[model samples]
Target: MFPLLRVFLSDLRRHPVGTLLPGVALAVGLACVVSSVLVGGAYDTAIQRNKPHTPAGSAVVIRAPGTDLPASLVTEVQQLTGVATAQPRQVTSGQVLGADGRPLNTPASIRVEPSDPRLSTTTILQGRLPRGDQEVAIDEVDAQRKHPLGSSVLIADYRTGKPVKALIVGVSAQDLGRPGGIAMVAAPAFATAHLDSTTIYGMDVVLTAGTPVDAMLPRIEATVGGNYQVETAAQARASEQPSPIGISSTLFVMFSLLAMATAVLVAGAAFRAVTASRVRRTALLRALGASRPPLVVVTVLEAVVIGVVAAGLAVGSGWFISVGMLSVLNSVGVSALLGSTGVTPAVPGLVLATVAVALGVAAAVTAALRPAIQASGVPPVAALSAVPDAPVERGAGVARLVLGAGIVLLAGLLAMLGIAARSFFPLLASAVFTMIGLFGVLGPLVVPLLVRVPGWIAGLVARFLGPAGAVIRVAAREPSRTPRRAAAVAMPLAGAFSLLAFGVVGSASLRDAVVRHSDAANTAAFDTATLLGWGLLGLSVLAAVSGVVATTAVSITERRRELALSRALGVTRTGVGLQVVAEAMLLSVVTAVTGSLIGYLYGVAIVSMLNLPTAVGPPLPLLASLAAVTVLAVLAAAGPAIRGALLTPTNALADN
Candidate 1:
């Protein structure tokens, strides 16, 4: 077993291309998990920093929308046992006026409060905190050069958008998050000056030393009752739960897991093809008295080696990739929730890396399973005779078809139940399961039918390549000759197109819904999700393309004898290249069209079933992704085509 394992490693070393392709796929699979964890953690930190309620280490913050918390409530909270100090502020957004009575060039927030050193989040660099109704404090960043201290400015009412005159009594340090001015004023002065002001949105509180916030939270909540929204430092740290990312956390995780699962299926398909190509060698070993268990062990061990090595590499790759991803998020103006203070990986990163390793190994094992079982089960005599597996029975094909239909029916039943029950969870679950089945089992089935159109196109292709056209035409005509193999390569391509379509089209639907019903911030946040979905979709496609390439490359490799014979009979290299191109085009095009239809439908189904007030159409991304897949597929086949073309007839026939 040891010697066999060593030989397997040696073979991997000898054929670095095959080993590296799958290894890279494993690395990519793990990288998704690692990078998402890194970004998710970083974003968690950023959220707490950006929207900090207790910057002064406060235990609780209470705010009410459309209503002001009377000074009496603050007094009550201050009197509680754990409560050290509770400070209330009137929160509103509006423009400030310059001394000349014209509105200041910038907008500002009104946090009307009297001087309180303990609970105030701001630091007065110069002058003093607002002591009068006419006095105000503004952030230095928003002041830039305007509204200098001693300069009178109007604090506009958020509702009326009217500015009231106030002096810039103090200048606080700039809060990067609140780029607009922050006007701090005396509460008495603010109430007298602004008649329409009512909302007291926040309380900044700090606890006594060694106070436990979590334990005291319930008491705070019970004290505050239904009238106020409450938050603490602990809650802020875990704030993502209420944010867009938190709301969509399940979707994000589902997508990532789907990628991991795709990796497994792809790895399985690639390994299956590789093993199938090695059937003769394995048969000879069996004939020479090699035991079945050892052969299976050797095969599984090879996958394990590949997984461990790839996962190790992926940890590093994911960190760097996460940094890059963070930079992208920053560029896109999502710094509030997605921003990280630094790129350094943290403790959670190690956990993510460990999970990546586990996933990589699991994927490899999953991919190796069926091949191992089949290879071990093969009779030594039949294997030595080089006989194919008994032809798939008509009934078996029918059963598989039925099974595929039943899965879809089950998914539909689940979806209908969700619609009737008015529960989105069931529908969401259906989508995940449906997608898994589509990519895993149904895609290949869908694919064989899609490729049938190419025979007509082959005639047009023949005029350009002459003899090569016939080879391509034959591939189109007999695509199902190796249905299982074709399906292996087709599934991922289909899945890729499907995901791409879902992202692009669904985003369109969400965009419409947002424009009609949601705030600009909501729209912006949804855009972030769309961008993330596209980003992940791109990586999945890249990984999927590799799987397709690996499978197709194996197909080409196994047909070296046939290609070599064609060459002997005077088929030119150009014709072989044409054949390879045709094969890849078939795989790419079929999956693209089929997956696009599926994805577009899925996207539409989601919006419709979710009862969102929007419509989805086949957006340009559907076509764009299809075109891109077609192009990438052609490029993926280029290397194999060149390699196949360069093979010498005698050597190819005599080799494997």
Candidate 2:
């Protein structure tokens, strides 16, 4: 066992490239999954914590649509049997000026009276409550801003746009329900804020001790004459339960599954390649009197060592990424409840152990099966010459082609029907199915189509550069030999870029349309242009970064061996690395150009279909984003290319 372990370590050191690629892939996939889970969980926990808590045995009342809950309705509910107190509440949204001179729109809640004064539970951090009209208290979160103590702020009433100025008199210790509480104003001050009418959104009531909430609920409803709904504190909390967490959880699970599946395929392919490349070495060991059982143990041990190390790194990296993402979310005011964004190390450890064990068993079994069969069937003499047979003519390709065509046809029909019906779901379904069909049936057919632009560029460069350009030409000529691997690297990047393209073009178009509509509606009182420009710049940077990272990773992995060989052939290691990096940069540039063009066309078409204002102009931001992504791709590729070049010439030649 010790000897086998020794041999396994030796093998890993010799074949670091093969060992490291899958590890990197696993780490990235795990990081994405873990980050999604942590952020989602934090959001869920925060929302749950902030939900308004009703007093023990308390109930809430809200008037049905045609009007706001009348303050009279609260009096009516208070008069009911077993009802202790009914408090009317109004909630509305208005823009308030922050200290930075930016208008921040926030929700505001007003109560006819403050939460029961006798209870003295609600913490008030600053000045006394409003004593007269025009005075109001702000939440601690908002009060920290320098809205002077006596300075008045204007808020538009919900019912009407009439602006009313309320003097900031005090600040509450805590928000009404959460970190950013509903800004509270006296009812009269609220009324003065241009509210169309004196109507309540809802009412909260406390029941007499020992009064059955179930019994009192119907009576309260009857008192309000079926024109209102009643709810207890427990019920209200339940209603506010974090719905986004469930949605984010489901999405994360789906993405994790997809990513894991991709990892498995990548890992399996890498294992097979490594194993096949080492068949003669294994045969030579058997020729030197290594027994079957020892050989099997050696193979399994090698896989375990690689899997464990990879899994550990993946788990640690994932946790770090999740924390960083959480910090960003916190900064953006997305998850105020999350104090920190990190998965417990224990959870990551357990996940890593599970994934490592799974991959180890898979690699061990996959690596051992064929070698075992060959060893059993033939002596070392015959094994030396043994070669895996070429793929059989199973008509798999034909069947895939047929299935793909059918799916494409179906997708086309669905798309046509969707356009006619103007239904969103149908259009979405059509696009998804079309992608599936293109990926399955037409992927091979389309690869040549997609590669043509790159091929031409490589050819033009090769013509000028002679032998130096052969690397580019070689990659273009035999792309099909590694189509699956190429797709593995390219698809994720393409998807991310496509998403970015859609976001940029769609947002730009939408913002333009909004500005046009706002101009017609409000005569340009709102500066939609200013908002749109800032938003586009921010979103473009985000999309470019993700695209660049994905593209760079794929390019480096796919060309590692070729880059190693170039170094072995007496080419300067730096020169070879630069070539590899250059290849990636070129591909990324092409992808960006194509993606932007497609995005623009698709964006314009959708906008037109939706009857939006169409504006056709050069996409300067898109161009800038593409250039930035290309630079990022080069930077990301450089590390792997240098690693590839560092392989000793002896080892590089030995592999071939």
Candidate 3:
């Protein structure tokens, strides 16, 4: 055991480059999964924790028919049996103008109540409840600026076309984080402002402890006569299942799984490549009478070591990243529903389980299987011989073209239909198909083209860097020699990047379209800026990961003997590695720039098709996007280049 452990560590140290690449990939994938789950779960938990504060048991919220329950519903529900007390509350959202005339509207919550003990549950942070119709209780967070305690605030009722000057009588901590602009005032004041009490957004029910909510629910429904939606605290909380958040969570999980699966494939391919490259070493061990069992065990041990280290690093990094992201989200008012941006790390069980199931077993099995079998079966002589180039399948070329054409057609059809229908799902579906088709059809042709750009750049650098640059050219020039293998490495990266780019562009366009339509329909009703920000953020994350994967794969490919030879001839490893990194960075930069341009055009086209106004100018987000892609390109290159530098001449030249 000790001998094997020592051998494992020694091997990792010796071939740090090879061992580290996969570990890094694994770590990245693991971090994404862990961070997503932790943040998502925390949001879920926060929503649950906050639901109980809506109202006491048996107290129901009431509103006008087909409208959000009005504050008056609290009174109607209080009249029911087994109900302790009902507080009539009217919630309205609108811009509050400061003295400077700037709009102070940011998803505020307003609750109008008749100052009574029945509504005393509303906790006041400072000052007393409103004594008159002209006074209102403001959320503490909302009162921070020019609207301090006892300050005059202008509440603009867009529906009424008037701004009401109201005195700030009290500030409540409980009201601080309510979604939309929340202000507590006397019900008459809300009525005076023409905020209709007939329409209730939601009703909270406070029932007696011994009373069964189920029996009272139907009766309460009967009392409201379908004019309002009534639910007990338990029912309301249950009903507020965070459907949108749930969908996002599911998407995050699915993407994480896909990333993990990609990591597994990458790990497996890397293992095979390493094993094939190390045939001589395996043959030498066999010549020394190393048994098949011991050989297999050693291979398995290597994978386990790599997997454990990667998982450990990933888990820690992921947790920190998630915490930090949550903090940012909170600070930026993105997740204002969440009072605190703090993320409670999910159960260690979830983290460990993800590592074990997705990364651990998959990596170990992938790394060990091929090596174990080949090491056990291949004769010592064949093992020592150079790897024979496998013949290319002629059919694959035709297949690539055919598949590519089919995918393009399918995506085009979907996009057309989506544009015609003005449906986002169709557009999203089109984007997915387009990405798949693009990689399938254009991978062979496009990757070679993409590879050449880097090759040329590397050659130019070779003028200054010399040998290392030459090695980059050599490896890149014959990309077709291992076209399938090269594509295997490049396709995943391309797919990921294409999807990310397309998704970002598509989502932005969709949001803009939705905003325009909403503005036309009812400008005062909805705001799409928040949605747009979230969509862009998600796409940025996707693009970053894709860039990382692509650059890493290219770096690994550049470290072969051909590369070593270049290094041997006085070219520094850093220079050679730099050439490879440069190529990848260049490809990504081109893709990002091209994709953004195309996406913007596509968005305009869709808007035109919808018969909506295409008068909007170029999106402001594109500049930020370009910056993000540039940063990602630089960061992604670091890992692979470091690996390329560590490749030893003897090891790289041995097989050649």
List the candidate 3 regions with Cα displacement exceeding 4 Å.
Answer: 1-17, 42-54, 57-86, 92-109, 114-135, 144-273, 282-308, 331-333, 336-380, 386-434, 437-446, 453-475, 481-485, 500-564, 567-578, 583-656
Q: Rate the local accuracy (lDDT) of all candidates.
A: 0.66, 0.53, 0.57
Query: Candidate 3 residues 125-187, lDDT tens each?
Result: 678777565787775545653467898877666576467777888875434334554444434
- 157 Cα displacement, candidate 1 (Å): 7.8
Of candidate 3, the 10-residue stretch with the lowest lDDT total is: 387-396
How many steric overlaps are in each model, in order? 3, 1, 34
Q: TM-score, each model?
A: 0.76, 0.68, 0.69
Lowest summed lDDT window (length 10), candidate 2: 387-396
Task: Please provide, for model 2 over 117-213, each residue's C-alpha lDDT reduced to its tens digit, 9 standing for 90 to 100.
Answer: 4322233456766645566766544554445456677655456544556787766433333223245545445555444444465667777878887
TM-score of 2: 0.68
User: Quick one: best TM-score, which candidate?
Assistant: 1
* Highest-lDDT candidate: 1
- Of 1 and 2, the candidate ahead on lDDT is 1
Question: What is candidate 1's local distance difference test score?
Answer: 0.66
Query: Candidate 2 vs candidate 3: which has greater TM-score?
Result: 3
